[model samples]
Structure formats: structure tokens, C-alpha cells
Target: MAGTGGVRPSHSPTLPSQLGATFPARPAAAEIVRDLPWDDTPLGPRERWDPVVTATVDLVLSSPMPMAFSFGDSFVLIYNDAYADLIGTLHPAAMGRPAAEAFGESWLSPGLGGVIEEVYRSGRPFLEPETQLTVVRADGARPEQAFFTRGHSIVSDRRGRAAGVLTVAAETTQVTRRLQNLGELTSRLAVALTVDDVARVVLGYALTSFDVDHCVFAVDDGNMFRSVRRIRGEMLDEADERLPPVWKRLPDNPQAPLVAAARSGRASFVADGEPLREVASDRHERRIRALAVLPLRTASLSGALSIGYRTEHNWLPAEQALLNAAAQQVAQAAERARRFEAQHGTAQLLQRSMLPEHLPELERFRIAARYDVGVDGNAAGGDFYDAFRLADGRLAMVLGDVAGHDVRAAAVMGQVRAALRALALTDADPPGVLAGLDRLVGSLGAESRNEEIFVTVVYGVLDPHDGTITLASAGHPPPVLRRAGQGGEAPTAELVKIPPGAPLGLGGRWQTGVVRLEPGDSILLFSDGVVERRGRALNDGLDALVAVAAGAPSGDPRNLCAIATAAVPGPTDDDVAVLAVERAVALSRSDTMLVAAEPTGPSRVRQWMGTRLREWSVPEQVIGSAILCTSELTTNALLHAGTPAQVHIDLNAERLLVSVADTGTRGSVIRAHTDAMSSRGRGLSLIEELSDSWGTDPSVRGSTVWFELLIRSTSDSPAS
Candidate 1:
């Protein structure tokens, strides 16, 4: 047969006669097979070879396609010139070795040896589109095992009985692995949430799928670059002292390969003997023969991806393109992480601002509050709580939750909370205040009308005189009341039995309930975040909270609040707010003063009120308002009632109460007095604005005009 175009093995004169003229002249693989020492193989010496085997070798050497013929039961391997290239550097040494000795267990794979056995048994040919094969490289490189698609056929003697197997195969490892790796890389990057996550994915795929010994991924921060190094599949600590200086130097360095790649926005290769100490550990640089640096650049983010090879290798266009595609994916993931970080930071700030700074302290009441943010990007939760004195001398406490944990929800919560506070001040009715809040939320604009804009609230008014709490629900969790047992009995905790109305902004009627809390009894109001879990039922969460709260000291509101919040189940993916109030027997009065019925009663009450307020260190603004309200009420008693006024002033732990009595009718009604110049009816209007609450009550002697001013914490900012 005529020889193919490539170099041919040299023909020796000692070659068998059958093959002497038939074999291609000077074929490279033929020389390797003919020169192989057959004494060491099952086939014995070349001269003692069977014609069947010798003919097969001649046929294989004449073929252009890579061919390997395994003859007899020992399956000795004799491959052609084309097959030597497929085996890499294992050629000459593997020429006449047994299949087991040359290819080892790799040749015995089900797809290869099983098919070869089938061909021999049937005396027929077996065709496989692709069969995997692994071969060691003569240079001993790690990526020696390659994959191939092959066909097997029986080689027969002149008698036509099958005696050996012939394989024709083509290597397809690089292209196949590239495709598989690309698919896996895409899938992993799709779910990556952080830059570190992207690095792990890229490094892991490269170590197992590409021709590299180590890899690194870095992110640029405008000022410098931060990086992570992974050798094979294991991650190296960033603080490891043995790492190369290049790993720590910023990517902006002019001489660094990674920086060069970033500057050029392309792939850069460091050839053999080039300085790679900048990019690898000292121990790594000793074995690193070449390096490939790829830049990962996006509009919002920039970084570098570098791979190191232990053996000198010229970068191929196909491999370079594959790496570039991977870099693009990593850049996209890094950009996403950056955006998430910015949004999360904004959420944190907004969430912190909406929470209360301190709780209001009262004479006979103990109050505690807490707010816990979720662990998600929308950390600014809609939960809120506030305790303040209303215009009717009652303590108002409210707990509410907006449906989401984002900026919009937070904004709505602020608006809704302010509206509730204002409404509670003017109207003492619990249900009426909730109804007004519902209307206010609906009026917040189109966005507030979204179904997701729902809000649940529990608003209550506590009367210190009788220890009665009037609560209204707007589709919120009911408040739990804990009653301390008398005579050393165990205390009991249970949810207040109240009608759960529709959530605010949903246009439904709200309902109110009143519960009398005895001395040492407490009430806990909370948002759903403190009780809700992913798989738990609403009732189950409520039960757990009740159990936790019941175990706490009945008189310690702060401890009970902490216990309830700490008992929330599972991950807190939403904001939580808890407000607890405990009622004591009576608030101790620090001082009291009375003015005898006389024409100078109003003047006398002013001096006493001013002195007591200043002594208590009340805010100057609050003291001025209290003094004015007391003077107006006392003057009305001595002038309109036509009788001497009896003025009384009392100060307690929570508030200062002032009362003026005169011999008169109870028909003095409060008028709007909208005109700025009107002076006659403005006294009551001034009292309405300055004091939290004021009203006229009939006494045995005459009518008493009483008002209360709240004593707030020094830390609390005055409400607008």
C-alpha cells in the first residue's frame, strides 16, 4: 500500500517477508512496532510470530486512521503511526506491550474490551460512535487520560477464525470536557449570591475540568483588589504566610500579570521562566511553568481570574475563549452582589431610625419595648410601637405591623403610626381611633392600596385610676394578659378574647374589648414577627409565646419582653416588635398643693404649679404649658362661676394633674374659636392643645375643670 503524507517508519531488512514490501516505507509507528523487543511479550520473537499476527501489523501500519491491533488471548498491542500521536508520549514503549500493560484497566472499560470480546466471539465487527479511553503521557503530565470514539473488528487467520481485535479510534477529550464544563459553570453562576460564591464555583470547575494545577479569583474595589486562592479543590487561607506577594498586592500594580490583564481587558499569558512569584506561592512558583490571566470586567465590577500550570504549555485559542466566557459569568455575579450590598445598607439605616429610643415611664405603670430586624435584604421591617399620654389623661400603647420589610412598607408604617398617635390623642374610643387609622392608610395614595399594603394593629388605652385597658384589634394578634395569683398561687397567661377585625386599609369594622388588670398583672402586645415561623401554625406560635411569657415574673415587664422575643422560633425573616405594660397598686405622689377659695386663687395656683414643675426638672416647654393651662382653668372658676375657686395640684410618677372647683353649673361648653383675634373662648382651646387631656366634671360643691400633662423621659424627643 502507498504511504500517507506524514513521516513513515524505517523498514529494517530483518522484517518478515510478508510485511517487507506491503508496509509503508519509513513509517514512524511501524518502526516503533517492528523494533519492539518481542521476547518480553506473549507474542514471543518477531520471527516466531504467526502470519495472522504479522499480517495484522502490516495492515495497521498501512492505514491512515489511528489503529491498534491486539492479537491472541494475551491481547498484545501494536498500533500505527496515527495511534502513537493519540497515545501522546507513551508510543514506542507501548508498541508491543500487552493491552493490560500499556493501557491498564482503562482498556478494559465495558465500552471497549466488552465490545472487543463481542467482535472476537462473533467473528464480526462492533461499531461504537464514541468509546472512552485513558492513556498515560510519555512526559508524565497529569492530564494524560484522554477520551476516544472507537470501532472494534475481529482479526482472523487465513482459516477465517477470529483470533484478535483491531480498534480504530479518535481522541475527543478537550472539546467534550469544554462543553461539559461550560454547562456546569453556567448553572452554578446563576445562583451565586456573593463574590466569594462565584470564586468557589469558577475555581472548582477549572481544577477538575481544565488543564491547570491552581487558580485564583479577585475583585477590584476601585482602590485595590481582594482575592482568594484555591489549589486543586482546596481553599488556602488568605493569611497564610507562605503565599506569594502577588496574592497580596493590589491588582493595580503595573508589573502584575493580573493587573495587565485588567488594564488590557483581555487574556494575558506569562511564558516559561517569566516572573510568576507575584501570582503564586513560593512553593507553587517552583513548579509553575506557565500562567494564564483572564480579566473579569463588567460595567459595575472588575476582577481577575488566573490559572497556573505546572508544565509549560502554549495557550490555545479554544482554551482561552472558554476561560473568557467563564470570566464574563463571574463578573455578572459580582455585580449582583454589589447591588445587593448597597440595598441592604440602605435598609439597615431606615430600620434603625423608625424604632423608639425610649419608653415612657409612669407613676403606677411599668413599660418595656423592643424591635428586632430580620436577616434578609429588606431588613427595614414594618413593625412599630409607641407609648404616650393621650389628650384624655389615658396611657395609649400601640403595636402594629405592615405587610412587608422594604422601604415602602417602612414609609407606610411611619405614616400610619403618626396618624394613630394623633387620632388617639383627640379621641379616647379605641375602636374609633383604629377606624380613623384605617381611613388614613387608605388615603396614603395608590401604592398604599395594594393588597400587600395590609397592616395589623392592636391599640389600647390604659386608665391608671381603675387599671382598665380598652383594646381594639385590626386583624392583629390579641394581647396576652398575665394575672398574678393571690396567696402564692402560680400566675396564669392567656390571650385576651377579642374580635379580630379586618386589617387596616381593607375597609372593615374594627372591634374593641375592655379588660381590668389587677395589681401585679401585666399585658404583652407584639407583632407577628415574634411568633410566626415558616412551617408553624399561628396558634402554635401564640402558644409558644404564652408559655414563655407565663414563666416570666409577672411584675417585671422588661424581663417578660426579653423572654418573649428570645423565644421566637427559627430564622427571623421579618421584623418583630414587643411592648409590655404592668399595672401596680398605685403610683406614689411626690407632692400636692391646694388653693383656698379666694379672688387670688388663679395667681396662687400658677406659682405653686410652676414651682413643682421646675422642682421635678420637667422640660421648660412642658412646664410653661402646664402653668398656662392651670391659670386659665382657675380664672374661669373665679370669674364665670361667680364663686371663689378651689385649686388643687397633684404630681405623681407619670403625670401632673391640676383641678379647679367653683360653685357653678356644668354647662360651660368648649367652642372652636377659629378666629385668631377672638379672646373670649380661647382659654379652653389653649387647654386642649397644651395638656394631654382636659374636661369638666361635676363635684358636690360645683364643677371641677381638671387636666393632665405627661411627664416624659429626658431622652425622648418632644413629639411634633
Candidate 2:
């Protein structure tokens, strides 16, 4: 037969020809045509043997596996139809051809050719479970040896001599890949600890270790589902793509089938092709090709886990089992964190309600106060401010901070604030008030184990009448004072620092100090938390308060108090109380005027009467009479009105009059004291008598008897 490449086919068997030349022919058995002899007969016995040899070669080559033969330094491949299918149409008639001439340089390999030669020379069978090789076609494309397994055997002659080497191989490329996937899945499962960890591991495995377009995991937070982790291949950026809208539009009639299934404590698998075809109303039918939804349920809550693929692919039973186990681990961790957060929230609310409601009112003072709780986690601190009206009508203010931050500290603050208020009402002095408070706190401390909870307080009481404040401190910041001027000028403020003492509950002695507050002065009291911030010195904070208060207006204590509080940057982190008192002064006295005059002459009295009565718009006759009366009174005082005389005047809406008096060696003795007298005593009595009423404040220097005489307008001058 002629091959496609124009090579002549040889009828002679190369293996027998080489063996016949090396060894003698042997006899054959009677019935079994075994061990045929090798001889050089042109139409010889081997010539008859050639037909059987050809049939054997045809049987081996027709087998499904690819087979090849090599004899006497020449090679031939008799590939079956299955092997031909693997090679495609390039080498369809690959039989009885030299290994080198048929496959060319592709057949030149030391490892493969040496193995074939060893089998032929040793007459031994060999098997390679896996082998890799490359095949070159007539075209320019290179076909690389995707994996394969090979079986080799030595073909022998009738003389038991090695004839040729035969090889059979089967492709195993798919099996090797399944093993690699199994390895990756095992590694990922080992490290998944939490729900977030499981989601990340599974999503990464799908994208990197399997054939997946995109993978996502959504965890339920009560009403809605949120994507916790997502992964994708080169086809998509998982971070950039929004999840399928169907995820958002879960089954509204119930819950999403995925969510409902998870909540029901079951897992679900949705095949991309069949499920949608069966259920026409499925909203996610068009969005996803395939899905495996597993519900993550623990003792407390339930959520869903899903894997998605762009192409329709069946999820194996093993993959579903792996995902379900991962979801359970994640669910338990979320439940623990939720419980911890709830407990913390409750403790915070309890601490906030323990502070005082509002500051008490003061008669001549304005009070402003504010308290802020700390933000440090769940712990609650004890910072409080209180003001109350004492029994004496004085305003008592207290600001204190209990050491520590916890439920115990808050409880202690409540007790201490109540004790201070009761003590303040009983004791008039500030130091005495604090001393009583300390005694009460000490008595309470005897039963408690928390010896470290001490209270630092600044307490004070304001006396409205004297505009004085007595203050005492138990290692607390000194109160601030802001004073306003009478004419509404800019005000000045100062910190009224009293002697510091030990904190309450320390069983140490304490003392009180006094501060005299003038009218329009304010007192500011605050706990140390306001001034003692992390990185700032307490003095710096105090100085800052002083500066802000100094520039603040003295309009109303409330307004000034706000300004001062605002001056300290806060969330006070402490309690603050400011009590301001403005002393009220009576500026106008309308009923009486005090006057001291010397008698220069009767004209001097007349001039005094003209000037004083003219400013009042009195009639000329009344003015003249007033001057005559004053002249008579002064002349009498110089003679009878007495020496070193002082005149006193009284005015009202209805009447006006003046009285003059002088220092006398003898106090004026009026008979009947009301005028029933003779003219000599009557002149002195008439001047006293000239007034509506009179009285005397006698001194050693002189006796001042002042009287009021009604001045009549022409309308009502009854002749007396």
C-alpha cells in the first residue's frame, strides 16, 4: 500500500527479519501454532507467518487506545479510531510508518524513546500511570501533552528473542483537574471562623478556585438584606457591580424565596434553566443563571447565604453541604455581639436620669446650670449640680463630682446630692454645711466597701440683704464672680477662691471662707470635670473661664451665666452651676429732704425761700410768706431758733413745708406739744406749729426738731 506521503509499504516484518538473522528457527507444536520458527526462505516459512503477524497488528491497532510499535531501531504507530479522533484528520492513516518519518522531530525524546528501547531489549512490560508529551501536526499549531497514561509491552519472535516494543495510552486530563479543585476547597474550609470569615472564604473560593462569573453573600439585618462579601472573576469587578435587583425585590408577598427558606431553617437550590421555565412569575428568573441559597440560622437570628453563576451549571451535593456548614458558624458570632450592645445601651439611660431637674430660684440672684454625661463606652460617671432655697431665704448652691464612672458612682452621686441639700438648710455657714455633709457621707461609707468614692464639692450661701456670700470648698474649683457697674458700664469678674479642704467622705476637717459680693455681682460654681480635660491644665481652664466671664455682659445673670458656660468649650464632661446675685439699692427717696442752713440774715432766708420755692413754681405771696416764716424761724434760732440750727423739709403730692431747728443747751420743751401756747413760747411753737407735724432726734451737740407746714396755693389757704 502507498501512504499519503508517497512512502512504499513493506510486506516483510522487520522484527522477524532481524530475529531470523540472529537466531535459529525452532519446531512448531502439533495442534498449537505456537513458537513458529524464524528462517530465511524468500517465499519462506516467515512469509507464511506474515499474514498472521499482520492480523495481530490489525487487532491491536483497532483497539480503542492509541498504540505504537518499534523494532530493530525503526518505529511504527498503529493508532485506533479513538486515537485518530484525538489527533483529528491530520494523521488518519497512521499505520506501519517509521516513528521519525511519521512524526518527525516530535518523536525525538530521550525519556520516551529510551523507555521503548528498554522494553524491546529486555522483553519486559512497562506501564506509566501518567505521562506528558506533545504532538506536532502538518499545520503550524503545536498540540501540547495534556495528561495521559501509557502501557508498554515487548513483542517476542518464535525463538523467544525480543522483536519490538508496543505502547498503549489513554488521556486523563479531566480527572487531574477534579483533584485540584478538591484540594482548594479543603484549604478554605480550614480557616473559616466567623460569619464574615466564612463568607469571604467561600466567595473567594468560587471566584478563584471554580468556574464562577460572580459570587455574593447577603446577611439579613431584620427587614433588609445586606451584602457582606462579593467576589468575581476577570469578567466583572465585584466591587463595582450592583447586586441583581431581584435581591432587593425579594419575594414581597412573603419574603424572598431565599430569605423565606433561610428563615424557615432550610436551604434552597435554584437551577438557572429549569426553575424559571417552570415558574414564570419568578422575578430573579432573568437575572441569575444558577443559585445555591443557604439560610444561616443560629439560636437567635436567621440570614441567607447564596452563590451565583452567570452560566447555568448544576450545583453538586458536596458544594451545597460545604456552604451550609459555613453559614451556621457565622450566625452564632453575630448573636453574641448583638446581646452585648443591648446591655450597654440600657446602662447609659439609667445614669442620665439621676441628675437634678432644675436649679432653685434666688430673690436677688439669677442662676443658670447645665450637666453633661461622659461618652466613654458604657460606664456612667457621677457629676451633679444643685441649688435650693434655704429656710433663711438665702440661696444655697452646690456643685460636686463623685469619683469613678459606673453604676455605683451614679448611685453615690444621688445620695450625696440629697445629703448636701439637707445639711445646707440646717447650717447657716458654708463650712458648717460642708462639715455636716461630710459627716453624713462618712456615716454612709461605713457600710459600703467602695472607700475610694469621694465627693469634691463647692458650696455657698448668698445673703441678699448684705450682698455677702460665705463659700466653702472640699477640693473643688473656686467659684467665679462677675460685677456690674451702676451706670451699665462694662463689668469685671474674678474667681472667688476660698481655702481648699479635703473631699467629703475623707473624714478630714474642713473650713469656710466669706466673700462680700457688691450689687450686680455673680458667683459661678462648677465641678472639676469642666476644667480637667485631658491635655489641659486646670489653671488654664480656670483662666479661660475668667477671661470669658470678664468680657461677658452683666445684663441678666442667666445671660452672663450662659456666656461663661459657653466660654468653656464643652460637653462639660462634668456638672456646672452658676448663681448670680445683684443687690438692689433704693436710688430715689421722694418723701423727705435733709437740709443744713446757717442764718446769714433774713434776706439770706428770703433768698433761700425764693430759690427753693421758685423751682417748685410756688406763688409769689406763698413764697414771701415761706421766706418770712423761714426768717422768723432762723432769727428765732439765732436768738430763739437756737445755735447751730438745721432745717428739714417734707414734700408730698398734696403739701410742701419746711422746719428749722438749732442745737440748744436745753432741749425744746413744748407745752401741750400741740400749740395751745402764749406768743413767746408761741414763736418757737408757731414755727413747730407752722408745720403739720413735728418730732425731734436729740443729740448732745443739738436738738433737731423738724416740722412740716403746709404751703397753700391761693386755691386752699385757710387762715390759721
Candidate 3:
């Protein structure tokens, strides 16, 4: 009524000055109504108006809310000052006219006239929750988007029959817009993975949705509270770098507005200064005149969300309901993240504790291990490895896997690892140690009443003084042994010959095998995860491991461990554990090259390998043999794999072992060596005749071609 400006009617005479006293002081729209010539219209003079019509007019004019009364069959309009402002430019002229004629185009708006007619015909009240319309603002020249909640109540004449309709329309554009966009907010929150993510999403959404100057989202964290805030459009969080910054840390003042709201379990509005002063202690907080605090309530989480405006503003019922609904969404999202993080944290902690904190610091032998969990990282897994010095001064190493991926499996694995260490301390013998672990696992399975407790393990004891390892396996894959070459002999690699006893839970006999390790020798102990793949045979995975072990760099145990774990080429649903124990030796020279999947790759490998061999003082004859053999392998790899290949060469005093590995499926056809005369299988023929020993092995990742060459001794004459 106050800010709205109306258009003046054309050629309309003003009422007499003395007539002003006839009507009490009123709003602009009501003053115009009192002075209008009612006798000229369908309705008679004011004094002769029906008692029912007069009473209705008095009721509409006295109220402040937007209300318009349509009287009799013509449905003449009689509205209060608030209604005048709602009608914009049509105010004074529309005072005594029919609603349809006065409101013009707006009268037929979806929720306006249609609702009014329904009430008039049925003598019933009709309501439209929300509907869009075009209405010109008092200060604008053109109409703009507007929405309103229309309510039409039937008004009856003195005869107790349906007469006309009285409409009450409350402008709800802001409320409706906010409600409609809430779906977008829900979608964003659904993907939130952590507590901090929920905070960022909630705080950011609230700031923009309510058009507030500042907003904060705080969650209860036992004694302390974590919060994320957005101030003047800048978002701030406590901990975020590699991950999305969620709620970090904030002051947990007990009497703070947010704390009070969470504790009160409801919404609190602060529109007055005295209340704002009580909550506003900081410089920024003191500038806020209005605040709305809504509690984030869920079964498992307690928190609060707050929005503040710099100026005084009253929150309506619709707005309050929308804020509460948003708070509910925030609560649900927070609960999901909380549960996931809790389980993830527990799984990681339990698995780490089961493995050795840091590898046993040993000087005589180099030992390294690596463990990677499957996709279900939230589930504690059974894969584990440990290396520790035995009481007899020998080193004991173990890599094992229990069945399933859950807390129970992890618990069993932990017990088995602990038992192994304890038994090894009492007796460094490999068979005794594994025998003890078998009994422990069987007892645990019986106690837990789990029928699927299958455990596979490899226990080995390395003698530093003699460079010999005693190993025992219980339904586990045999360990890989990479032996350094002897006089004029090529180095060799194979799965150690050992007894494959039944799994621990089956209570099978345990036996041990002994292997003599030459200087510069390396042995790899791994879990079934190294070779167990879906839709493939166990022997296929095992054969792939031997190829990887033979081709990998043997000088460093850590490097070998990494290469072995990554041999899968792609994702796997099994956890992998690798432990490599090597006997350091002299006269070892190793070099590697990455050959691109192009025509010129074989030439580059030849040049690189020749230079490395010459630098090592390799005999010219030996260098020529290596260079020629490596070229054929590299060429075959590029032609068949269609992907980059890794050329790894290891040369010692007695021999050189070189391999070319590729990750590609196109090589399957080439691997078969079809068409003996077409140059496809020619490379294999040359390798077989020139090299001492050679083989081709294929794994899930791809395929590998390897060869060994023995250098001639100085005492031996050169080939004629």
C-alpha cells in the first residue's frame, strides 16, 4: 500500500471537500473508493447498499492482507489497500468495478478467476497452492514473472444462497522458486562421500538458496564440533587438499545460535536486535540483523544449519518449511558419509596392524614386500605378509591369504600372522612354523563356526651364512627362484620344486624343501592373489608370474615387488601380496629400455643394449649375440602387441638374460607363430638357433618373449 503507485483515472471529478469528513482517515485505495460515484455504476448509492454487501465491504476494507470481494451477480470489486498494491497500476479505477473487468488479462490467470468461479457455483472454498502469472510492478513499465497462492471463499447474501466470491492471494514467488530448485540440491548431496562433502554442499546451497549474506554448517563430533562456512560468497573448510574440503573446525560455543538450534531440535529465528546482539560477538556476526537456524536431525547424526541476512527480515511459514526440508536432506547425506568413513577407517587400521609396521631392517639380505587391497577396500581383507629376524639369527618370511574379505577374515589372518612370528621365534624351522600356524587356523575356524575358512601360506627361512632357503607351503603356489649364472652358463628362473600340502583348515601334512641360492640370486614369495583371476585357470596365472619374475630387474627387491603386483595389467577383485628376498652378489649389471609401439623401436633397443653392454666391458662376441637376439624379440613384440614394450636386460659374469614384455591382445595371433615362411615365425627360428635358451609366455596383461645367452670364457678359443 505504501510503495505502490497507481495510474490516475481520465476526466474523473473529485469528491466535495466537505464529503471528506463523511469517511474516516483511510489508505489511498480506500479513500478513492469512498469518494467514487457508486450511483453511476450497477450498484446503487452507498447508503442503500444491502446489509450483507455492506458488511462484506467493511470486512474487506478493514484488513491488511490482500483481499478482494466481488459482490452480487455483476461481481463488483471491493478491495483493501493491500489488495490495491497487489493489483499494481489498476488500483483506484478497479475499486468499484467487476473483478473480471478491473483485473483484465490477469483475471483469467490459471489460479485467479478459475478458482473464483468454482467457489461461486458450488458455494465452496477453493485453493490453488501455487501458480505463475504476469503482473506489472508499481515501479516498472512492463509485467514480470510472479506467482501467488490463491484462496477463494464463498460469500452468501442475506438469503443464505451463493452470491459472489472473495479472493485472497498471497505472493509466493520466492518460496515457490526455492522449493522447485531443491531437487538440484538433493542430487548434489546424494553423491557426497564424506562428512566434509555434506557440509560444503549444504552450506553452499543455503547461502545461494535463501540469498543470505553468510551461512554455516556444523556437525556434532563428540566433544568438539566440525563446521564449514561461506562468508560473503567465499567458502572456507578445515581439511581439504587431495580430497574435497568438507567441514573443518569451528568454535563450539555452547550458547552459540547453531548449538542452541541443534540442542533445541527446531528452527529459531532472530529478527530483533537484542537477540542478535546476544548471539553476535565477533565483528562479522555483529553486522547481522536477521538469522534463521534449522537443526539437521537424523537418527544417527546431530548438527545445525544457519543462514543470516544483514537486514531485518521475517521468515514466513512456507520459507520455514522449505528450510526444514533442506535440513532433512543434509542430515540424510551426512549419515551416509559418516557410516562409510567409519567403516573405511576401521578396515584400513585393522589391515595395517596385521602387517609388519616396517620391514625387518636386515643387512645380510635384501627383503621387500607390497600389499594392495581389492575394490572392496571398506571390507577388511585376509591378504597379509611379514618379515622378521628369527631368534636363531636367520630371517623368516611369510606371505599368506585367508578366505573372504571381511572383519572375520582379517581377524583370522591377524591371529595366523601373530602365531607364525611366535612359532618362528621358538623354532626357525619352516615346517614347524607352518605346522603351528595350521593348528591355530583350524582352532580359530572351529571357534567362529565358519565352514569356509580356507588358508594358504608359504613360510620360508633364509640362512644368511649359507645363502640357502628352507620353504614350506600349505595349498599355496610355490615361490619363484631366480638363479645367477655359472661359468659360461645363462641365468635360469623357475618355480621352486616343493610339496603343495592341503590348506591349513584341512589339517594336511606339512613338508619343507631346501634350495641353494647362488650369489646375486632372488626368491619371490607371494599369495594366490598374484595369479588368481576370474574366468582363468590357476596354472595360467602361475606361469605368468614366472615370466614376470624372469623379466623383472633383479638388483632391487623393491622394484621387483612393484613389477609383480602390477603384472595384472588391469583391475582385479583380489588382494595381492608380494615378498622378495634376495642374496646380494657382485658382477651384476642391469639396464632397461621402453620400446614404443612403432617401426623404429627394435633399432632403438639394439643401440641402447649395445652401448650398455660395451660400457660393462662385455666381450665383443657376447655383445653381438645379445644385440642380435634382442632385436628379433623387440621386433616381434612391436609387430604383435601394438603397444609399447619393456626390454629388460640383466648381465652377470657368466651370462645375460634379456626379455621383451608387452600388454596387448593383438599379439595372440603373432604368439601362435603362424605362417612359418611369411616372416611372422622367422624371429622364433633365429632365436632358437642363436640363443642358448628361449621361451614365450602369455598372461592376462599380455605376452613376454625371453632368451638367455652364455658368454664364452677367456680360456676357450673363439668360434671358428
Q: Whose lDDT is greatest here?
A: 3
lDDT of 2 at 102: 58
The residue-by-residue lDDT of candidate 3 on 1-720, one tens digit each, is 111111112211111122112222335666777888999776689898777878877887887777778776666888887665455555566777876687666565554455566667788776655555455443333545666666777877787886677777778887777876688789989988777667767766876778888788888877656565667845332312222332344456667888877766878987755344655645677788788888987887888898888888888787888888888898899999889889866777677777876677555466767777776557889998889887778888888999888888898899888888889999878777777887888887788787679899988888888988888899888988987566736556799999778888777888889997777678888887778888888888878878877775343465567667765555678778889887766445677899876666777888999888877777787788888878877766666566789998876554577878887634222222322212333466667677766655433355567776765574432221
Question: Candidates ranked by TM-score, best first?
Answer: 1, 3, 2
Q: Which stretches of candidate 3 lie over 4 Å from their true place?
A: 1-181, 184-194, 207-212, 232-255, 271-289, 298-301, 310-316, 332-354, 363-381, 405-407, 442-451, 462-473, 476-501, 507-720
Reference-based lDDT, residue 684, model 2: 41
Per-residue accuracy of model 1 over 247-336 as CA lDDT, tens digit each = 233536767777777666878876676557664435865677778888988887777888888877777787778778878877787788
Per-residue lDDT for 1-720 in model 2, tens only?
Answer: 011111112211111011112212322111112222323212135345444345545655556555554544564444444444333333433344555565554344434455666666676777654643343322334454455666777766566665566666666654454445546655655554334444555566556644555455555555755444343533333421211111222332234555565667777786674333332233344455777767767676666666666677777776665566556644554454345445544554555456544456444444555444455335667777777788978878777888777788888888888777777767768777778878867876887865666888888777766867788889887877776555757777778868889988786677777887775566677667656666677788888888877775332444444455556675645533344444422221112222233334444556766776666565565555556556655544444332355554433322344556565532122222112211222234444434444333222234343444444453543221
Instruction: List all candidate RMSDs to the true structure.
Output: 23.4, 36.4, 19.9
Candidate 1 vs candidate 2: the TM-score winner is 1
Off by over 4 Å in 1: 1-47, 50-69, 72-163, 167-182, 203-214, 229-251, 278-289, 309-321, 343-353, 356-397, 403-408, 421-436, 442-453, 460-471, 479-502, 505-720
The whole-model C-alpha lDDT of candidate 3 against the native structure comes to 0.71
Computed on alpha carbons, the lDDT of every model, listed in order, comes to: 0.68, 0.54, 0.71
Q: How close is candidate 3 to the true structure, as a TM-score?
A: 0.47
TM for candidate 1 is 0.50
What TM-score does each of the candidates earn? Answer: 0.50, 0.37, 0.47
Instruction: In model 3, state the lDDT of residue 302.
Output: 85
